[model samples]
Target: MFSKKWMNKSTNDYWDKISNLKKTIENADAIIIGAGAGLSTSAGLEYSGKRFFVHFSDFADKYGLQDMYSAGFYPFETLEEY
Candidate 1:
């Protein structure tokens, strides 16, 4: 198993807290999921080979991103630059 340590040990701990929030939402009057980068990752929307490269093969090869994580920080000055 991937260590919970990697995902849960961070000071921000957005992943664990978000999981807790999911459970809380079940009982709350309203549940709102704000989709953002971290949430997308939690939902398994990783930017690595599968999710990003599959759709953006050309981009991946040109920029040398093995996965989506690296792609986000492609030293990008602009979207067009990458």
Candidate 2:
């Protein structure tokens, strides 16, 4: 979690954060980047629009859900149903 000190920081503060990050990365032995939904979506694994309609049309009709992300927030009565 970020602290309130990070909020409303000046340009110099941003540069300081970036410099610290650069040093940390430079001194690191290894870095593991965790790519999530945004990465996959950017790589064409979209969860909405045509793809969502194609794969999840039935769920959309049954549950009134729009897309995969919205479906995750659906109030399914059971985990199996979800």
Candidate 3:
């Protein structure tokens, strides 16, 4: 479980981390950034509980999808099903 403070922290913390890491990114000469759920979460796109359920209820009602992680695996019978 995460500490309550983790969620309550100012959004600036995310930018601060990115700013502090710029030197490493520059040193590595990174050309492209690969982003996924973790990166999104760090930048504040976390989904869980009511938020997750609310956003993905279509997948849940049709195919019993409980989360986006599982929704990615769902095999649909039609494009509309997705």
User: lDDT by residue for model 2 over 19-58, one digit each (tens)?
Assistant: 9999999999999999879898788886778889898999
lDDT of each: 0.73, 0.87, 0.73
Worst 10-residue lDDT window, candidate 3:
2-11
TM-score of 2: 0.55
Q: Rank the candidates by TM-score, best first.
A: 2, 3, 1
What TM-score does prediction 3 earn? 0.48
User: RMSD in angstroms, all models?
Assistant: 10.2, 7.2, 10.6
| Best model number under lDDT | 2
* Candidate 1 vs. true structure, TM-score: 0.43
- Please list all clashing residue pairs in model 2, or write none if there are none: none
User: In lDDT terms, how accurate is model 1?
Assistant: 0.73
C-alpha RMSD between model 1 and the true structure: 10.2
Judged by whole-model lDDT over C-alpha atoms, candidate 3 comes out at 0.73
The model with the greater lDDT, 1 or 3, is 3
Model 1 Cα lDDT, one tens digit per residue, 9-40: 56465778888977888879976666768887
